[model samples]
Target: MIRDLLHNKKRLSLPKGTGILFAMMFLMAPVQIVAQDTPRVTSKIDSTHIRIGEQVQFEISVEADTTTLVVFPEGQTFAPLEMVRASDIDTFRNKDRMNLIRTYALTQFDSGHYTLPRQKIIVNNKELYTDSLQVLVNDIAVDTTTQKMYDIKPLAEVSRNYSDWVRYLIWGIVFLAVAGALIYWFFLRKKPLTQEEKEALLPPFDRALLGLKQLEESRYLIQSQYKEYYSELTNIVRAYLEEEVHISAMESTTEELVAKLEMMQQAGKLNLEKDTITNFKSVLQKADLVKFARSRPDTHGAEEDRKVIENVVVRTKEAIPEPTEEELLQREEYIAEMARKKRKKKRITTIIIAAAVLVVALGGAVTYYGFTKVKDTVFGHPTRELLHGEWVNSEYGYPAIVLETPQVLKRTAIELPESLKQVISTNQTFTYGGLLGDFHISASVTTFREGVEFNMEDAIQGSVKTMEQQGAKNIIVKQDEFTTPSGKKGIKVHGSMDITLPGTEKSEKGEYIILNFNEKGAFQQVIIIHRQDDRYAKDIENRIVNSIDFKNQ
Candidate 1:
């Protein structure tokens, strides 16, 4: 009956309670499925309270399926609290599920109560949030009653390490070696000699004999190179005659050479036998025929011609006359002059090379180290010396002002006019250097009579007027409020000015800073002046300004 009614789309009546229960079961089923798929995110801190500047570790954890991508928060997401560091995300896996945890180190400098905002975590493109945390930062307690206070110590000098300069020294050595090699190769090294040069240096007769020996040992005869052999043989005898007899034998034809020899014999210049002359002429004509006319001579014939040529050279050398004493002396002087010229040339070359090397080394130094650094190192700068020198920390004047300076300040007597003595009780001054020097510092304290109120504006105007009276011109004035490290407030008057040197018309751009403070019925002033565009001077001024302190009476 129930199946027939349900199949026929008939409304089957049931108890009201049963109908409501069925409806509730269907709605809860979908909710359970979604709850199972959602990722879980939680956060906690190591401590709820910490001292100021103490670190707290805050961690966030997420559990999700392996296929889900989880991203944790980054950067300074915690306001009023600083993130000291962030650790890498750690992953733990269990079958198809994974857990990711990330830790952040957080701290706060000020003592206060703070709340860490909820951090956002993303899982599979869905946003998830962790719970907010509350933290309290407590200040550290100090027992100032029993603690003793000491004067601020002077700045300790830091010794520079010279190890860094070793690199420059090594580079200098490399450059010097390169320069030396170039000089030696171009100016000092000696080269080897060629075969022709070696022969030319020998005596003419000896050179001719050597050439004939070389020709005999050559392969020309074995290869049936008759033309080359005969040509070389004739050249040997021609070279000997040209050098020994001072004749143009190499350029002359065989007929011309023979005619010239006969003329010299007739003129009594050469005592030559007819047989020697005939043998030289016959060999030359045969060599010319072999060279120009393609005439071939047998190896035996060529060997005989070489023997004749050697004999002729010997006879010609014997016929030449010996040089006289005057000629020998003149030859010696010529050789001496040539040697002197060669030495002078070498000296000039050496000087030029040395200059170039010096220039290169200097340029390298200027390139590596700045020009200003090299210049200051070579020619000392006063301000640079003061900046690197030992410094002094001292107190000066009543209600004493404490500061550090490169040099000790000297006390100078201050004279108050009798007319103004009734209004001013005492004036004390301390100074270092002068207005026109590279750097100057002056501090003064002036006590007033009873019921005299000190005016800082008037004092600033007076100081500026006094500077102008002392040859400061084109002054530009600027004013600003300044507070010392000890919380002493004062007015800082500073500007640029043109200062004329004493007894000179030249002016230099200068910078000055005046700090004025009035305390305990006394007016105190600290003035600093330095040349403009001086980096070391600027550093000194900054150091002195920063070190100024007022001691409580």
Candidate 2:
């Protein structure tokens, strides 16, 4: 030992404080070695014997002490054989030398001489083994003639007692209340038309008066409660719109209510003419700023606004057209027809929906006794007949297919030649921002022959009309034709184009060219014109054209 110690000086001569560490390490060395070597496994049986169709548990475990630990079962056969579960589990060491085992349980229901192999458990630098257990299974035989199972019958639904008077009494109470309301409305219409009624019928100015009086009483203006001022102004406007146009203005947003009013005006139903609504919208928007924006109106602006409101009230009174005989008759007829149709439709729709419900309910009636036919439709036919795979390829437009197959490579790209520079429409730059760009020109145009082969000439019709309506600057197009440098069989396309390049800088639209197609139209083309600069408009057009493909695929 002295000679060995002299040979290996670092072995026993531990430094200061190292003695205690050495003792502890010595005490734990065997445990650490065992932990490093011996792996753990688990085994259990849910039951010894299960019926023929029943399953039995066969579990094996392996400690995950190594980076690549695995277990394999050998030799032992399966019984009651049906694999139900195979799971991996983990474990930890307890205060004592006991190991909390992780486990995997496998089960089967098939019967016969199935044996499980010995399980091999692998841990760090070691392998462990578990002995396999045997299982026996037997099935019980039954005589068809002597054995039978009785099925329980379902409980019948409890019948509702139509003979009960309580339901009738409740219905009677509802009918009576409704009848009372009808009587009140009928009588109320007759005994009205007093000062209140006269005021209600007045030009809606009285409400403004009342609001002004309320404002005066509350002294809100003196208190500089601008929020209240704007709120009242908005309310007054909403009330006015509701009364004038019969719209639910009070409950709507400024945009929603204004949109409705404008729609009514466009339909020629509202009496207010052009500039009237423009002013109305401005006033409302201003009031909104004061209310929600927490802004206070100066005395002049406030007074001017109040006067404007009064002026609007007066102008609206003037704007309210004196009903011509023809107009009055038309309005009355429209109202009467709408009311009559509404009543008739409600009654008929209610009856139709109720009848449809009854028909659906009758589908479950005993008259549906063709269970064998239904079964054949659902399962028998499919089982008896041959089946082909289902194909769903109706709208297989380029939408589903990708331009490129592999992730690394990109799809085809192009930039249009400067010679093709032109604008289709002179106006609505908002709608056509692609006309201005400076970049190399390379283009690839593929017509999606599979989809509706849109005629390029016809496609411009819609755009032309829209721009015309917007009064966008117009440019003349000189017709030109180009035989596509490439095409597919059947019809070779001799395409034509009409260019409308912008004439002035103010008319910055430089590309309004329409590509007219002949008999042969294929995949949508990539018409990437060289952009003057990197622009979104040109990029969009290029993408749209390239996205279409009409290969035989």
Candidate 3:
């Protein structure tokens, strides 16, 4: 009976609600099929374990329809792991469907076990998540017991970089070229003479004659240029009268000039012939008419006027009296004074130009390299030279203080007074420069007599007091423990102060460092003093302090 009931499903009776559920299920079947066709996202890593600071590749793959838009994970979304780099999305297509794969380089600097959080991806407005991944970062292994130790390497000499100096050198060459050109133009160079200059060099009488001859050869009269012809003719005669007769003929009117010449003849200053003066006046009037009233003269009339002007010049030249001996000497003196003034003017001009070039060159250098560098380059800085110069490394004094310095320190005798002779045995000093100088370095070693204990604190105090005695005022003191490169420990006393040099009341800001060490009942001190703002001096102080070491007895 059960088998008949199972086989005869069409005959079996169903409830009313069950039929509605079946209809609902039949309608949702297509929706489920479409949901299954949605985009799929998956993620994987190349390795689950990596050394610290090492990179691991993480890949994300998405499968979607060609029409679907997909967005892969981006940025630092992976917690506990840093993304080093993200690669471009790679796509593979098969008919209507496509696969997109994006790779990310990830790294972790720390050693730990971490889980890469699930990454979010979007496809066609639907959100999807990739499965979380496990990662392990292991520390690099080291066995220090088997490793060998080595001494710290000494400072290697750094070759100076001349690339920056190349520009300065080019500027220097340009400046030299400009200076040479100016000097040659103002002083050494022989310039070709202009026409006017060549004319001025001739004597006044000869110059006027040359002008008349040149005008006679000119085309002014032939070209109906009557104004030019007459103008030149009159100028020649007027210039001759002015130079020979000592009258202002060129600037005076024709009437004023004739009147002056007649008065001079009456006074016996000039022995001019009345007929010569009359002819000179007539030629000047005709030239003025041609110039102002547009009066034209025939070529033959202009030629006759030129002849009269030439005759008048000759008569005026003959009438002029010879100068006395005193007058001749005065004229020579005047010419010499004028020549001196001309030379003085040239020298002044040359000096001004040279100074201008120097200022410009210095300004350019300061603008590019800075004022400090330019000043040091031109004038020289002692500290700067010592900073870059070859250094000396040697041991000094007993109980051997070994260090390096810019220059080898010279040994100096320190005489102890009779009062302290009983307490101190031997004191040796090596020094360069002094307290008042720009930079100073000194090393002193003093061995106390038997049964004496060296006290570092007392030594520091005594050193400060000594600086005060040497014109240092307003001193600030700071103390610290210092360790040398060779593992010797010492007391470092450093501070700033104002130093007044002897013979001058002005005080300059200064900085100082004093390093004191005690070994085998002997006290050793290294003292450095320099201008407060000297960077090179500070570097030198640092290098020397770092290089200090005690030699074994």
Error of 1 at 220 (Å): 4.2
Question: Per-residue lDDT of 1-553 in model 1, one digit per residue for the tens?
Answer: 3344334442556644555565566657764334465689988899989999999999999988888988888887886688999999999998878888999999988787888888888888889998999999999987879987789886465664444356657877897788888888878888677998888889999999999999989999899888888888888888888888878999999999999899988887788888999988889888989999999998889989989988988888888767889989998999999999999999899889889879776788799998998788557788987887778899998867888998888888867679668878788889999898888999998888888777789889988998898889999999999998778888999999999999999999999999999865678899999999897998899899899986543
Query: Which one is best on lDDT?
Result: 1
Mind giving the per-residue lDDT tens digits that candidate 2 earns over 1-553?
3344344546766565655555566667664334454455666666656666665656554544444455444332332244554544544544433333433344444444545555566554456667766665556667868889678775455543333245547865785576546544543335657875765665665675665455445655677877787678778767876776578989998788778877876786666666766776777788888877877777567656665665666566566657899989998999899999987976676566555544553455325845554444335342112111121111122311222110111233234345323321111111112323321111123343233434556544543453345333444444444333234212112121222345544433334333333222332322222222223335443433333333322
Give candidate 2's TM-score: 0.23
CA lDDT, candidate 3, residue 56: 92
- Please state every model's RMSD to the true fold in angstroms: 16.5, 32.3, 18.3
Candidate 1 lDDT trough over 10 residues, lowest sum:
1-10
TM-score of each: 0.53, 0.23, 0.54
Off by over 4 Å in 1: 1-186, 189-208, 220-278, 281-297, 301-305, 362-433, 438-459, 482-491, 501-506, 515-553
Task: Report lDDT (CA) for all predictions.
Answer: 0.86, 0.49, 0.85
- lDDT for 52 in candidate 3 is 92
Which of 1 and 3 is ahead in lDDT?
1
Please identify which of the two predictions, 2 or 3, would achieve the higher TM-score against the true structure: 3
